[model samples]
Target: MTEYKFSDRAYTKMIFHAAKYPHLAINGVLLAEKGAKSNSVVIVDAIPLFHQCLYVTPMVEIALMQVDAYAERENLVIAGYYAACENFYDNTLDKVPAAKIADKIQENFKGACFAIIDNKLVTLEQEEVALKVFSCNDGGRWSKSNYSLQNSKSTLEAVSVLLKRGAMKDVVDFDNHLDNPKHDWTNELLNKDLKQIMAMY
Candidate 1:
């Protein structure tokens, strides 16, 4: 429910975000009609307060279908699928590097609502942001966390330049969670560079 104005900043973010998607498609995991029509998903046109974005509120629609299994319930209930992926063909499909357009979304133009990534339905927010950033950034490809979000048009790249100077320690990695994942880049050049810049914080 955060409403944003239709300004250059907002348009810039929309362009970066929408460049990955061409159009919306189905989730591709519907049960056989005779098997159990219990769990269902729906796509609704969202008249958003910010940028007039479209959102696919899956849980609300699935609940209307009436399923009894908690696992199945949790398995597919999401609110942003239609706006994120094209078909959600597979779970391992990470295509952050493939989005082709970056045209900024107009303030109240009613943008599409979805929740897929690399072309698969997803529920992880940070991962989604990471994927979007991964799509927007060109020239070099690497994954980092808010360190990059700090570089969004809203932040005006000020944070990125600062981090490039010398920053803080214990910076949040893109994969940071209850327990840090070992595969994540740490003690790397970007981390060292950012840590140094964070000294100003």
Candidate 2:
């Protein structure tokens, strides 16, 4: 049974997306590369879907196609699907769109998994937490698995900005009337002040 390893940058990306829209359910694809030491997957980046209606919308399909093309060029594979729900302890992950999404990804990438953001870590305690990974078993049932994080300077910088911005303090779906631009987080990642803020931590 192959396990998943999440790079800090990729983990932060998933948390940032969940915090960005805490009230609604957010889903995304995890890009990963084969590990060198053993049979494992190293999650590299996430492509988030802020807007989702029903199951697997046409827009989501198009986005996945584009992501797959990009991943191929980068020598990465669509290794998994991740979801953050309205409630922190939402147990519908394996029963939600994520199940179908993970199944679809596994069709091409056999060891694909699903990660559900542990909402409590974001809502209650402002501390480190491990996101859970579920890999499909022989019967296509999701089995709980383990994953470790890889620390990096970029990830530290990203965390600094999230805290300084008081992102977790905001109310989820507060800006319901507004639409989130896909590059919002990317622009923040390039913010000049981010370096200054990261230096403090």
Candidate 3:
């Protein structure tokens, strides 16, 4: 099985994106570099795409084009897609929103993965990763896949501290950028802050 390693930046940003809009469905893309090992994927960052009308194609297409360009510039690939279900209890593969997007990612990147935010584990008290990953098989089916965090315990602790500090508000998604171009969905500042914060934990 291919090993997917999620960085603290990618993991926390996805969680923050979902926490930023608890009642809404959120979706995003994962950017990654091929790991040193042949069957390993290193997910480095996440670009939050939308929280409104996930099924809309025009906006999704626009966001994807931009993300693809950005990934190219950064020497990364669109390795995966992630979604957070509006219904807190919906953590299954069938409940993943914008699933076709995941399929499209897989079409381009054979190692593409789909991750669903496990809402039950989204709390500050939660110690484990809140994401449940699935990989597309040769049969065109999504099956549960294993993933690891960069620094499991410290990552969880830092996220909890960030949540307590209400840092999630700093995470901007494509919808926010669309509403106001000044809102940077790339989250350069937040990414820097997260790295600094993680180091302290």
Candidate 4:
């Protein structure tokens, strides 16, 4: 059993992508570094895939290659995959698409995890931070576990810049675009965060 630490920036990106496409389930890769002394992983960042289907398509495979190359340059490993279910109450990550994606991730990185964003808490007001992480064992069985979050000023800066540039909307690629009316909730949430960040300056 390894402990996982989710940096503020990494969590922000995960939540942002989830919020950005509340109607569609979005998936992405988690980048992390091995900790000293103990068997632990510190998630540094997330690379989201706004365009994904029920199956991992050729495009998704190609995108993964790019993510791998990027990770190499950054000196980080592909730790796992994170996804948000379209329905807020659906916390099941062992289903078709998630299970299939996690298998691919495990094939690449041994002890890879699959995290599901807690959309119910995220979309509505809640006390707990919105994320649930699951790891695949040697027997290829998935198990739920707890993770940590460490806030970083650098992450806040990065998220703020992306918001200022409207990067969320622009970064969506390949499949369906995020033109759904439900995006209003996401947009408002992001705007509120951006404003709070601006107020600090």
lDDT of 2 by residue, 1-201 (tens): 767788765676677667777677877788887442334878877766543452546756766776788778877888888888776678455545557778888887887878988777654333555377888788878888777766444454556467567653322221221245443422234333434544555
Candidate 3 residues lying further than 4 Å off, grouped into runs, are 34-38
User: Listing every candidate in turn, what is its Cα RMSD in Å to the true structure after a full C-alpha superposition?
Assistant: 17.5, 4.9, 1.3, 6.8
- Predicted candidate 3 versus true structure: per-residue lDDT over 1-201, tens digit per residue: 667999999999999999999999999999998443426888999999999968799999999999999888888889999999999999898877578999999898888889999999999775878999988888998998889999999899989988988888899999999999999988999988988888898
Stretches of model 1 off by over 4 angstroms after superposition: 1-154, 166-170, 173-175, 178-201
Candidate 2: C-alpha lDDT: 0.65
lDDT by candidate, in order shown: 0.25, 0.65, 0.89, 0.65
Q: Whose TM-score is greatest here?
A: 3
Of candidate 3, the 10-residue stretch with the lowest lDDT total is: 33-42
lDDT of 4 by residue, 145-191 (tens): 66776654444455555645555553333243324534332233544
**lDDT, candidate 1, residue 29?**
12
TM-score of 3: 0.96
Position 147, candidate 1: lDDT: 15
Q: lDDT (0-100) at residue 145 of candidate 3?
A: 89
For lDDT, the strongest prediction is 3
Clashing pairs in 4: none
Number of clashing residue pairs in every model? 25, 0, 0, 0
